[model samples]
Target chain A: MSRTLFFTSLLYRSTTEHKRAIAEFCSNVKMCRLTEQVVFSDPYKISQYNRWTAPYLDEDAEAVRQDNDLKLEIAELKAKFCERAQALLHGDLHTSSVMVTRDSTRVIDPEFAFYGPMGFDIGAFLANLILAFFAQNGHSNGEDDRKAFKRYICQTIEETWSLFEQKFIALWNEHRDGSGEAYLPGIYNNPKVLQLAQKKYMADLFHDSLGFGAAKMIRRIVGVAHVEDFESISDPGKRAACERKALDFAKLLLKNRRSFVQIGGVVRAMRQVEE
Target chain B: MSRTLFFTSLLYRSTTEHKRAIAEFCSNVKMCRLTEQVVFSDPYKISQYNRWTAPYLDEDAEAVRQDNDLKLEIAELKAKFCERAQALLHGDLHTSSVMVTRDSTRVIDPEFAFYGPMGFDIGAFLANLILAFFAQNGHSNGEDDRKAFKRYICQTIEETWSLFEQKFIALWNEHRDGSGEAYLPGIYNNPKVLQLAQKKYMADLFHDSLGFGAAKMIRRIVGVAHVEDFESISDPGKRAACERKALDFAKLLLKNRRSFVQIGGVVRAMRQVEE
Candidate 1:
């Protein structure tokens, strides 16, 4: 008997609370075969589904309508991307919502967790981490130390995506109710076929990841909740410059999200940013 | 027989390597009596005066112009505002640069530390902490814990600013050099006049502090180094919404900075912001 528990809170909950809730939730999940709703569709439930929430309706009715329209378009695109990609989706994947304790890796906050486009979760998680990494300078000194921290983050991005893909594929192969649908049976199991398929999937994921990553990065730097790293820098000019760089990086990545065919390309693009 | 050290760092000497060299540099400042060239000049040379630096320019063109422009502006502003305010400055004041060890509370990162706006440092430090308080939600959680954390932050802001002002005024009263034409001897020091003067000075400082405080708050949320508090939020929409509120609060404060002639106004504005 497996019980599947749903994670409730994300923003207000601390890491320890997050961990505890996840453990309990997982225990419940193991006991029940409940299909947790990761993404909320009901307009009334939008607040419950997202971390950084805003009322769906803004002060201006027209502006609110426009924003909603934009969201709908994005959703349509997301659905399209998922359909085209035809891959195992983690549904809602982002690091803050994820919890692990030694032996088993369990996802706690699954308000939006689902199976659709695996790239969405992978991309969102990596993008957010990168944003945090660039902002780390505001909080600490020691250039060498900052560098070490960045290296750790970059490695995590690569490793997490790599491991997730490995696990997802393994799960799919083992549990796949073979239907000979759009995907080839066991093509991922073949060395040459698997390599080609992996490359293509990675390319698609990288592109989507870059787009969402840019959006997340841009919104944070200029949108709201500006990082403390720049806050610690007393010079307003220097702070402004750092912010400009982050925004620039975001715009570049978002605009070229689809053009990225490999993970190396994305890295190279990010590296080219002067800041 | 007595050695007095100013915690402020000289502008030029401040670098990544020299981040930890301020304590040593203070000793050099006292021993060398480097004030003539380092403290007051048409253009001060801090980094160049140190033996470790290589010659980059025969003269820093921008610094010379900046010094001339800033000096004139300060002198004019001082003469105007002096009627209602005190003259003392803390060039660079913010958290992460300030260190506290047991009984000692001294500012460390003061490369830009100078005397201009007395409230700038105080306001900046408080603003940084406030941002951090909100950001803590990204990692930790407990309903009561969050409530307690917020209360502690609010108290810290109130107390720290109050204490800083009291200490600053006390220092000013003790060390006021009577050489300046602005000082009319007993005209200001007379007990009856002194009370009125203190009231006015406090009012002006409080107003200026609010403006700077608002700027620090707004920029951190909308500027460069974005906070992690919202990132910790698993729900994307909610996180974004909360951040929007923070930004909105910052913008309001900045726009209404000039209106903050009374400290009560500043406090009221902050309290008015709905989160």
Candidate 2:
């Protein structure tokens, strides 16, 4: 997902051409408003479509509605989601959106694609992966506990973020002298200043990813649409328990995402919530 | 100018209507990109179009180019100017863009109008008033020092900001139950939470206006177009002295805009720069 976004970020409007072409590309799709309503808005409020494992998760869903701090954080994210056209995005990158084999990986269903924050796509993939990890307990039996599988998911989460950060920075360095309008070569060409800019850019992106990831997680659990990972659990009790863990961690992450400096902290927190 | 923006903010896309209409209106105009280039980007860099009172402001213009902190701050403002579609802006709201009489005030020449941060328009008007205040000395002779008129200009700057804040918030309170997408009625209906949300929104807008205002001032002096307030001075030395003061204050405001909480403090700072 990060690799996909790396290529997307490279496709910017050239300084010589008409900027309206790119601006129209972003606005014409209406993807920003769509994401704002579904991923950021409808979930937190009393929307007619919102549902969860009724009775089991009813209180949890109501609690989300009542949480003012969470609502405040979500509003900020919603504004950023609507405003920041950082790069082209997959728009709806979740577990089912990808096809993977032993050697190759392909992403599908880019109908929602538009120019938006790169973290949105990255966060969507991570959120689905975390949901899958939590749902493993429901699939576990006496013969197969799925403990090792959960650990593998955790490792994959960490690796995906680490690799994404490395590749994204490498691409930026490669294109430092390019025609990107955000950072001009004449001003940011100095190595020290370039480093400062990159540090600030990456830090902001990391927090955005975490915050969006948590929002995705919360919506799946208590919002209009439930993920198949939790739905496939069959037993409502077990499913609700797994969802509650994910929900707890997501709320914590969304409220205090800035306190998290790295991906490792997030994975460890996920583990702590599972216990 | 603020009253113009208050009305502009009222025109928003209804949730039931096609958002594409408003989105296209913004992108088609390409006002955001134009402002980003002229007001935010061109002034900070060595553009061919850029000019100043040559020989006199040679070092000052060079210092503007060399200030790494100023460049960094400008980059953030450029990104915001390009991204945040907060409301419909007058776009180029400098003093010349307005027509005023004893009985009526009318804003003209909205050719650059589009959906953007409200601060850009507010800042443009305020920046022009500040420039007019600074250029008063150059316009003065022994008999008419223009001291009273200078104070009047400062008073206008202060009143414009104060009135804008009050009227804008009053409109928000009146429309608390409206279809505005930024603050949902369900989530922000509580008096305490609504107050918090308004405070945060206004504060952010205030800082954004100051940053954009400072950028507008800098470009007028050092970028492609020079404001007539200074240009009308005729004597290059007098014009340069007035410009240098405006430029210095603009740089300070741009870099430290967040530290300012009220318009009164800003007016005081402007007077201090005159001394």
Candidate 3:
């Protein structure tokens, strides 16, 4: 089957093998009559990221280093999560994967999607938010505009998680009975059993989500294709200052991700600044 | 030799042994001899990080997923840099490290010091500046003050590198003759070779500085102790916004550290808001 892989050049570089695996997996998931088809899985064709064509998007040298570091971190997290729970993963998901048109918000590229862990998808989206903020900084011409942009991005991340969680729970609750019995049968039977199972599942998701989110956030800093917010600074010293800010955020996010249950906790953590 | 180790509550429990080795090596450098003499290098004083001392900082459950991902990424970066540079490093060195009681700036707190890579120290200090900016969202008390603080941090990182390069070179220039050949029948000549050797040595230093700096920046954000900038938002959505800004910075710093040479490159980099 022809399969496509979608990834951010700034964050990931996939091999032919990686792309094929994702394509094959997506094909399996799409063919699974038991799972819901609301989220369509399709292999997207990708054009090479030609540095010459994208002049302004030149990979900042420092940003590349940040990306390299970030990639290693993501690999570690993935290994840890795999060891903890053998859940399948969506592989990658974020604004880069989503497409918005007037009234619809659709999940587009599923090339990197797989059955690794549910939390991975959630974290990917959230991590992109951190990426987006810096990306926008280059375009934020005024202080007020920059502040507004910052607020918007933060709010979006919080809302996205809230929305995703609520939606996921709603699906789980609705499919509790024999309606969609093909995939999950006695999994949701008996109230007490269901409660215990659900809690454990949720807990797993929480831990995985936190870990995955951190990986995504930290990789951008030290991985190969560092973000523009710090790179575009034209002055090495100023860029270094910008990088320091990003590092602080990475520290806090990884440290506190587990404790943050409500959206407010996440918000509180993000608002912190270095003293 | 008597050695002392202090512990930080990092995600990964670090037992610094090689750090002692590096410290010993640095101590042996006659030109840069330490005033605080260590009588012995006993392994008994090695301290372990108290992993359970703090509560899970992620107050918001949803954000946990994102933070966890960041944690992995940070870990990876630190590992890569330490592995590549031959970890015998002075862990932390920033504006704070330059203890300025009056007009003089003296380096302090080699307590966190270990043998990793020289870049880790330089990068850690520089990365903190960007941390201050994003952390300003939560960590900084006032908006205007945060702005000023950010500016100062950025400037300091720039100046630190510039001054450091000059000082490092000056030190090499003055001390390379090996005590002027004891009984000099002619003018001393070894010093010139020592000075010449510095060029090659300094090039390696520059590379390490960039890589370690990238690691330092990523760890602060995604490691166990999350920064306050993103933590203080009270709204998960808002907080993530601040985090995004920080991540952007990390990406840039890590990517460009290698290519940049002078303070000017760093300053220009920090000033850039976008790609």
Number of the top-ranking candidate, with DockQ as the measure: 2
* Candidate 2 chain A weakest lDDT stretch, 10 residues: A10-19
Candidate 2, residues B76-149, lDDT tens digits: the string is 77766665565677789899988899999888887787656788888988999999999998999955679899
What candidate 3 gets wrong by more than 4 Å, as runs, is A1-76, A80-90, A134-142, A179-196, A228-237, B1-275
Model 2 ranges with Cα > 4 A deviation: A1-11, A15-34, A137-146, B1-11, B15-18, B26-34, B139-146, B234-238
Give model 2's DockQ, 2 decimals: 0.39
Q: How many steric overlaps are in each model, in order?
A: 44, 0, 157
Cα error of candidate 3 at position B135, Å: 61
CA shift at B212, candidate 1, in angstroms?
1.7
Model 1 misplacement above 4 A: A1-275, B1-90, B136-142, B175-181, B227-236, B258-271
Model 3 chain A: lowest-lDDT 10 consecutive positions: A36-45
Top lDDT model: 2
Chain A TM-score for candidate 1 is 0.57
- Tell me how each candidate scores on DockQ against the true complex: 0.01, 0.39, 0.01
A1-275 in candidate 3: lDDT tens per residue?
A: 00111121101222222223322343433322111111110000011311211223233323322332333333334333321112234455655667789998667655544434456667767777765664444444536577777788878877876666565555555555533211122222345544554455455566666666665555555433344555566655444444455555665665555676666576566656421
- How would the candidate models be sorted by lDDT, starting from the highest? 2, 3, 1
Which of 1 and 2 is ahead in TM-score? 2
What TM value does model 3 have?
A: 0.36
Candidate numbers sorted by DockQ from highest down: 2, 3, 1
Question: By DockQ, is 1 or 2 better?
Answer: 2
